[model samples]
Target: MAYTLHNLPAKLEASKMATLGYARVSTQDQHLTGQLEALKAAGAETIYREKISGARADRPQLAKLMAALQPGDTVIVTKLDRLGRSTRELLDLIQRIGDARASFRSLGDPLWDTSSSQGRLLSTLLAAIAEFERDLIRERTGDGRKRAMADGIKFGRKPKLSDFQRAEAIKRRAAGETLGAIAKSYAVDISTISRLRA
Candidate 1:
């Protein structure tokens, strides 16, 4: 079903429910000025700013904003990526917000507002599509791996120790040699010798 901002119900009251905004730039070279201005114009009372990699989920400013949210509050982001790096992460954050009896919206994507019933439905549909996409990618990856294996293409890291070295290490261990001594003789870490047992 199609949903638009205009057709949607009246926006939540900012007085009763705070409309907080989040602005993030993936690198220190980027600036948050534009996002801040847009968010302020969109009626965001308070804003959280962060300059960090989006791939990192442990954003300090985002953590503080999430913790500060209360029931009836709405979180606003200049873009969806400002909230999360990927669709799965976005959905996870939205789920947490919903659980807190709060809502989320992105100025970049008007269709993604959790403040209304239609928006909530859209959110569910988007999340399902994201999950389906991930599953398809995983299936294709597995198929590719199987095909490569059939073609005699090896996968995974090359063995750190040769077969002869491995066999010698086993013999040394059986001969009551210390693990550190075996590792030193082979010029490899102790973990490498331990893995030979498997």
Candidate 2:
């Protein structure tokens, strides 16, 4: 059954409810000025800002912000990606907020708000799209690797020592030459020379 705003939980008053904003940047070099301003304009009473990669699971400020949420409070972000780097994480966060009786909103994606029935529907649709995108990327990458393998193309770093160089090194070592001498002569690391024996 489709959820309606009227059938669900009572609508909380905007004045009585607190809107907590979260702003994130991928690197320390990036600035959070624009997001901060937007959050402030959106009436965020308390803002949590971070300059850490979204791919990283450890976000101290985000943790603290979520912990501080109370029933009827709303969590707001400038964009969906600011909340999570992956679709799974995004869905998990939304679920967590909902379980806490708090709402979630994204200023960039207006439909992402969980304050109404329509917004909730849009969030589900968006999550499906994100999953579809990730699947497409994985398929394309696998196909590309298979194609490259068929073309006799190498994937990783080139060997530092050629096969012929390795044979010569082994022969020289058998003749009582030191591993360091062989490594120095071949312009490679001692570990490279040692690895040839194994």
What TM-score would you give candidate 2 relative to the actual structure? Answer: 0.62
Off by over 4 Å in 1: 1-16, 26-31, 165-185, 189-198
Top candidate by TM-score:
1
Question: Could you tally the backbone clashes for each prediction?
Answer: 0, 0
Tens-place lDDT digits, model 2, residues 1-198: 111112223454333677889999999899998988898888886788889999898999899888878899999999999998877899989989988899999999988889999988877887788789889999999999999999999899999998899899999988989999999998999999988862
Q: What is the C-alpha RMSD of each candidate to the true structure, in Å?
A: 7.7, 8.7
Over 72-148, each residue of candidate 1 has an lDDT whose tens digit, in order, gives 98899888888988878889999999999999999999988898888899889988999899899999999999999
How does model 1 score by TM-score?
0.70
Clashing pairs in 2: none
Q: What would the TM-scores of all predictions be? A: 0.70, 0.62
